[model samples]
Structures are given as C-alpha cells and as structure tokens.
Target: MKRRVAITGVGLIDPLNESINNFFARTIRGESSIRYFASKGDPVPVSIPAVYCADFKGDDLLGKHRTISMDRFSQMGLVAAFDAWTNAGFNVHDRSHKPNAGVSWGTALGGTRIYEQGLREMWINGRERLPPLSVVMGMNNACSSHIAIQLGLGNSSLTYSVACSSASAAIGEAYKRIRNGEANIMVTGGSDTPLIYGVIRAWDGMRVLSPGNEENSPSACRPFDKSRSGLVLGEGAAALVLEDWDHAILRGARILAELAGYGANCDHVNLVKPDSSGQAAAISLALEDAGIPPKDVGYVNAHGTATIEGDPSEIEALRSVFGRQAKELAVSSTKSTHGHLMGASGAVEAVITVLCLKNSIVPPTANLKDIDTSCEGVRHIRIGDSNKSDLKAAISNSFAFGGSNAVLVFKST
Candidate 1:
C-alpha cells in the first residue's frame, strides 16, 4: 500500500501578505499586489512594474548564514523554510525532528543576486576573480543546502531546478520519498528573488511579457481576460512541512491537508511551448494517480500566468482531462492576486488552494473583466469581495520554460 503524506503546516512569503492567513484574506478580498516598478535607472531596464513582498525581513533570518556570501534567493529560501518549520510547531534547530527530517527545495535560479554581484566584482578587478566561495554561494543548490545546514537535517538535501515547476516538483518528489518510507518528515518548498535585470531582459527577449501600460499597475498581468497581455514578475518564497500521516497524528500535529496525488510530464516536442495533447495528459495522469475521478474535484488553482499562450493552453488541458465535468468546476487563478512568483509559484498556490478547500472559500481571479471565449467549462470566481471558509480540495498546475508541467491533487486532512 502507498504511504499517506499530509501537509502538517504551510507558510507563504509573498508580495500580498507574509503570513498565510493575512495573504489568503487579502487575496480573497479582491486585493492586488501589483505595484509600480520604480525606474531605478539602468540595469533595471524598462520601468517594468512588479509586485514585491510588502514586509520581508530576510536579514533577520539570515544570521550566520547571511555572512556566508549567499544571495537573495538563498535568503528568501532560508527565511521561508524557517517560518514554515516554526509554523508547523517544529523547532528546526531542535534535535527531536532534525535527524528524521530532510530538505528538498527548488528554484528557477539560485543566488541570482550574488551572481550579479560576483560578476561586477570580476569586472572591477579586471577579471582577476577571487574568493572560492563565489560559485559555492551562487550555486542553485545553495538555498537547499542552507536550509539543511541551518536545521541540521543531516539527511538528503537536494535541489531541483525545472524552471517554473521547480517547487512543485520538489514537493512532489518529497512526497514520494516520505511515502516510500524514506523519512518521517521533510521540509520542502521553493523560493526565488531573481527580479534582477538579467532575468527581466531575458524574459523581454522572448516577448512573453505584457506590452501594456506598465504605469497602470494592473496592465501587466490579467489572467482569463480578453485584454490579458503577459505575466508580471513577482518575488518571494513559500514552504511546507510534509509529514507522514501517522507521524503527524502521533505528534498531535494540526493536519491541514492530505497530499493525495502528484503528476508531472514534459512536452518533449517544444522547448518553450507546450504540445496541446501532451499538456492534457499531464493533468489526467495526476487525477489518475490520486485515485479520484474528475467529478470529485470541486475547485482548481490554475497556473494562469496571464500570458497569451499560457492561460488558454492550460484551460484546454483541463477540459481535456476533466471532460464535461470541467464546466461545473470552480477554477480560479491565485496568480491574479500574487502575480507569477516564478519558482515559488506552485507551492505557494497549493497552500492557498488547500486553505481555500479547508475554509470552503474559493479565491476569485481579480481584474478579469471578460473571460476568454475559447476557455469554456472552467468556472471563474470573479467576486467583488471575499471571506474565509472551507473547501474540499484544490488543484494547482505549474508549467515551466521547457514545457515542464506539474500538477498536484490536494484534499483536507
């Protein structure tokens, strides 16, 4: 029999709200975190407005690790993991759970901030690079190892980088390990703070970003809308404490939700685009693994990044997977509120979706004036305001740059 894995605790550090409760409350109330991106002169090309964390104190969580030449991504990961560990009522530094726990984190880019800094130093010193810690601290696995060392897991500490699906894949892989009796507990999630100039320039090069009025704030991202342009850049981290069902109950832990199923696939046909049929297969594979019929799903947390290709492609995938039942399902994109958090997007959204299911409240897709025509069957919650309630379950989708797709099925514990 397959082992059961449950989400004992979850935490989010996003642009809208840092705490989970505050974040969901504000999100459900039709709030938008999208704000004007200050024109900080060159390097930060094209006053590309973005949504950033309102109250992030990475320095406070940095401590000894802060001086280790870590970058912004590592800092976000450490802070988020620490907060999630504490929220789950587990003292990460405590010996009680350290030995049995592990750290498997994910991110699109690790230490982008430090990489930029390192490159600058190299130029200033005429390419005579110094400090062996440059690559070590700037490495992508730095965040995962940081969490592992800080908490002293002394076990498997792996970092998976699959573009946007990095965190979702991390959580799914973590679940697989625990379900297979690898560990009793695992601290898994993702973080990314690569709002650096290089990343944006790279994104712009693809023409995937919305060319609308960056000054208007909301013009950047508008999922499921007729005038939807492109996804807005967002930064933050979200972490979850994944524990065995029996282990959580033994410790009297507050069981939030059961991670019933996880599925992933790659559209091998394309590098940056998805094959229509293959994308749908990924969603179906997830439901099949969950052992739940399509009719069982009440809500869906879409990977709606508001891109011209992303939103409709995902809608089609859902329709193909869920068939006629898709029409009755309530599907909302939390990205409408939080923007695209890149690496951390899927994990944070899963938390939001799980909370919505627990409270029976579905977060609406804000700023969606008109739902697109091609994407039918999926019900969009365009409520004017919101409140807290419980729900049965929530489905989160994460597709990355290279057609890397991940889907997760979650239910209340």
Candidate 2:
C-alpha cells in the first residue's frame, strides 16, 4: 500500500503578510501589493510597480548570529521553515527527531542580490572586494542547506531550480519520498528574492514585467482580463510540513489537507511560451495519480500570470482536461494580487489552495474586470470572493518558463 501524505502545518512570508491566516484574509479581500519603485541608477528607463515584502526583517526572525551568513532569500526560507517547524509542534532543538526529517527547497535565481552586489563592488569600486561568505551565500542550494543545518534534518536535503515550477516540483518530490518510506516527514517549499536591480532589469528586457499605469500601480497585474499586460515580479517564501498519514494520526496531529497527487511534464516546445497539450497532460496525470475523475475537481488555482500568451495557454489546457465541464469549474489566479514570485509561486499558491479547501472560501482574481474572450468559458471567481463549502478537491497548476509543468491535487480532510 502507498503511504499517504498529510499537510500538517504551513508557513508563509510574502508581500501581503507572514502568517497563513493573515495572508489568506488579505488575499480574499482582493487587495494587491504591487507598488512602484524608482530605479536606483540602473539602466532601466522607467520605474516599475512590483510586489515586495516591505516589513520583512530577517535579522529579527533569525537573530543576528544566524542571519550573518545568509542572504535575503535564504533568510526568508529559514524563517518560513522555522514557522512551519513550530506550527507542526516539533521541537527544533531536539536533535533526536532530526534523523527522520529532511528538506526540499526550490528557488529560481537564488541569491541574485548577492551576485549583483558582488559585481557592483568589483566593477564600480575598481577593487576585488567581495564578501567572505559570498560564494556560499550565492549558491542555489544555500537555502536548503541552511534549512537542513538550522533544523537538524539529517535524512536528505535537496534543492530544485525548475523556473516557476520549482516549488511545486520540490513538494511533489518530498511527497514521493514520504510515500516511499525514505523519510517520515519533509519540510518543503521555495523562495526567491528577485526584485533587486539586476534581476528586474533582466526581466524588463524580456518584456514580461508589467508596465504599470501611472494612475493605478496596485492594479497592474490584471490576470485573465482583456487588458492584462504582464506579470509583476514579487519576492517571498512559503513552507509546508508534510508527514506520513499514519505517523500524523499516531501523533494526534491535525491534518490540514491531503496531498493526494502530483504530476510533472515538459512542453518540449518553447523556452518561454507554454504549450496547452503539455499542461493538459500534467493535469490529466495528476488526476490519474489521485484516482480522480475530471468532474470531481471543484476548483482550479490557475497559473495565470496575466501575460497575453500565458493566460490563454492555461485556459486552453483547462479546456482540454475538463472538456465541456471546463465551463463549470471555479477557477482563479491569486497572482493577480500577490504578483509573480517566480520559483516561490507554486509553494505559496499551494498554501493558498489548502487554505481555500479548509476554509471553503475561494479567493478572487483581482482586477479581472473584463475577461478575455479566450478565457470566457471557465467559471472564473472574479472581482469578489466566493463561498463554496462543498468543494471536495482542488488543483494548483504551475507551468514554468522552460516548459516544465507541475500539477498538485489537494483534497479536503
């Protein structure tokens, strides 16, 4: 028999809020966190509106000693992971429980801020100045490494870097590990702090970052709307504590929801553009893994980045998977409010999906005033929140730039 996985605890550090309850409450209120930031002597021509964790003080959460060696991204991960560890009722200082736990973190453009700072120091200062811990802090695996060391997880520590799908992939792999009995518990999530000057400039060159209307900066990310422009970059982290169902039951843990299935695939098409067929296959595969039929999914947390191409591609994929019933599914994209968190999008959205299942309230697609005709058929939860107490299962979709697609199925417990 396959071991079941239960989501016992969740942690979030985002532009909207840090705690799960606060984040969900703010999200359901249809508020957007995107704001304008003036360029700091960068080559970028204009200021852009982006989502940022304004009040996050890593030093306050991790302490001066622990924060000294970590970059902003890693610090966010450590803080979120710590929140999850405590929420799960585990003693972080107890080394005896460490052997049974592990960490799987996902990130895209890890520690880019440190790299950018290093480059500035070398080029502008005309000196070979660099931080002593720069190499370690700039590594892609640094967040996972720090999480493992800080939490004393000894079973395994892995980091995934699959563009936007990174976090979902990490969580899926963690679920498999628990199911295969490799570990009893896994702390899984993703983090990315990509709002720095260099990263934003690079993204701006790609023409994917939203060019906000000077009048209304917060309403820039208009996902599924006819006037949708592009995604607004955001930075944050979210973590989930996944435990074997039997172990959780024996320990009398309260189960938030069950991670029932996971599916991952690639488009094999474009480097940046998404393919409907590839996304459809991943959704179908996830349903198959969960032994669920298409009609049973009451909600879909779409990977709607508000890009002209992305929104249509995702809708097309949903149409393929649900067929005529696609029109009946309640779908929305929280990215409309939170902005895109790059690698951390999947993990943060997963937490939101679980909260929706637990609370029976679906967050709206903010700024979706006029739905694009292409996305018309789907029953999108737009503008305001919707209450659906009978929702049984929901799927969170994450399709990355490299054609990597990951789908996760969550069932109400």
TM-score of 1: 0.94
RMSD of each: 2.1, 1.4
Worst 10 residues of 2 by lDDT: 37-46
Residue 3 in model 2: lDDT: 94
Write candidate 2's Cα lDDT for 250-295 as tens digits.
9999899999999999999999988999999999999999888999
- lDDT of candidate 1 at residue 170, scale 0 to 100: 95
Residue 308 local lDDT, model 2: 90
Weakest 10 consecutive residues, lDDT, candidate 1? Answer: 385-394
Clash pairs (backbone) in predicted model 2: none
Predicted structure with the largest lDDT when compared to the true one: 2
On TM-score, the leading prediction is 2
